[model samples]
Target: MAETGEGSRPGYSSAVELRGVGHGKREHAAASPPPPATDAAVLHSSVLDTIGEEITGDALPEGHVLTLEQIRERFGVSRTVARETMRILESMGLVRSRRRVGITVQPRASWNVYDPRVIWWRLSGPGRNAQLRSLTELRIAVEPLAAGAAARSASAAERERAVGIAATLRALGEAGDLDRFLEADIAFHTLLLQASGNEMFGALADVVAVVLQGRTQLGLMPHHPEPAALDLHEAVADAVAGGRPRDAETGMRELLAEVRHAMLPLWEPRTRKG
Candidate 1:
């Protein structure tokens, strides 16, 4: 789910050796037996995630190159651990490993942007505002249509389930229980999309889930959700349950409009920075 991109050019700086990695720790490993496979796996994940974060967060910009030896030395990991990390990264389009070039960060445009972990890294990085706006725009474009389709196509049990989840969402939101609210919120979105019987919309539930969770994780959402937003959710659910496609679409649109309003401040700085 991690991704990377960028290459060395006139304006680009190529980091030959990583800052906290690509260094030495020979004696320590020499003193102890190699770790178990499980420990090795843990080591691999730690190294992978650290490097992944750096790549996506731009700590290691595109065109930066690191060697297997550098990674092993820097992370105090084995050559196998280092190799496997880069291998996974390459698969994610974050980096490319070659015999002579070492591991080179790719361009941003080359990243696996659809991968949720990639989305998380971007959202967790300095470029989060742009990612948030892009994902929300996607949700706005898809969710309303999904809602309408759910109203028309969903089974009776599915429709009732939507209303139930919305009711649960209302209770959790009013109680200021953000954690439960987030799960219920994800459930509501996921169910509606799935019940729409559209495979494409269903697949995007992950995207919507990430956006909802990221909003809470970033402290962007309030301790208590807006009353009107909660009402709109209920309205959408009710419309779906009642089989009113137009009302379902309108209610969903209104709910996302509130989301857009809430995110206005976050997006404002991107405009100014541009």
Candidate 2:
């Protein structure tokens, strides 16, 4: 995994900060409290997010052992906070805790990759390029199928909304309004997945949304999205509106193909000095 550097997102570079989101949603861990309600809760969230990112970013590599006392000292938190942080990480499979052996960082394979915080950490850190590639590939596989399904079964209102979002995407992309463009882009995918009428596909809406926002936050998105890609967004939406499953599927695949073309180089292996 690559370590975050100058081009990294805001909270990612700081090593200890909360990451707000682009999509009006707060991407906190499932185990976390709602909005860090209390002072102690804020402390716990801060500690958990910081240590979680360190482990995800490979700063704390596999087999790195840590003690509750060490965490308490390093983060200036109470032993209660330190213990809870490690306990959450252990439950997420990012670490293992033993009575006397201490908390040990586990390998990537041991991580609960589906956890949204893990996904956010990986995408925001040096592992960004890799996570984007993996997530994009997943989008390529799932979104097309979702588009086709939506074409077949989407409610009349959903079909109309898809068209409107697609129109918004094109306008924002052309006008260089990336912020609005990103929101519209999120709407485009979110609507398609939910409208797909498949529970499994609908469940992945967050995963897709995270990667979309991550791309922009990481500086991978261009000043303006390519015109061809914008056209395909419309194509998929129109296909869904027209009730053409095959067209929706094909259009989505072609759209994602352009995404892969634009993003592939970011994930290519590069020589790094230790």
Candidate 3:
């Protein structure tokens, strides 16, 4: 989200305003109808991003109240923009509203943890290391199983696509093309999940994409992916293409184990001295 003007509400300085519980009310003429479509789209995206960051960052902790009036006044946005922002957050399981209780941030357990945006926000905040560990553990559990399923069920085209993307990922990684490597890596894993022929596994593509991108963006990835890691990815693709379920599963386990090992230091607790 682009950085923009400061909030209009007193004691709130963020581009998107978030008022505390005890802030006093200000009576003003109702906000003008929202701006043009392009401007409105920008407003919506900005507000949604800011509010989402707050919730996932725990700045607006669970049970914090976010009233419609507070949103409108603090952000200097029309009621429509404010309501739409709230709707987006609600759909993502971040906040909920009631007649008298207002809009309250929901607990983390209630969130749509698999949603890419939610994953990004969480990774951007204080919980990043923990989130990374959790996501990697999840990938370790599921991706190997998905690889085996893909070996049995994937169509010819799906297998071909997976192999092709894996090749591209290996090339990009070896060349130290971080951005393109991240893209191909996402495509490779996503294809594996979709080819598994299990709806639940297919739906996890976004979650995997988020983790891959998050690792690179946060500078956690090595300058070039390890050669063995690239080789394991190719092995997974070849195994799935050849309908070798056991080999596919084994290749994925080894790849994820390498990843987990690389990430372990980040996940360890740090000590401070006086």
Tens digit of per-residue lDDT, candidate 3, span 23-78: 11321211221322222367877778778888987589889999999999988999
Alpha-carbon RMSD, each predicted model = 12.1, 5.8, 12.0
* Candidate whose lDDT is highest: 2
Best by TM-score: 2
Q: Give the RMSD in angstroms, all C-alphas superposed, for model 2.
A: 5.8
Alpha carbon lDDT of each predicted model: 0.76, 0.78, 0.76
lDDT of 3 at 262: 83
Residue 79 of model 1: what lDDT? 96
Clashing residue pairs found in predicted model 2: none
Order of the predicted models by TM-score, top scorer first: 2, 1, 3
Global CA lDDT computed for model 1: 0.76
lDDT value, residue 28 of candidate 1: 22
- Poorly placed runs, candidate 2 (over 4 Å): 1-40, 270-274
Model 3 spans with C-alpha error above 4 angstroms: 1-40, 270-274
Candidate 3 — which pairs collide?
none
lDDT of 2 by residue, 218-265 (tens): 777999888888989999999999999999999999988888877777
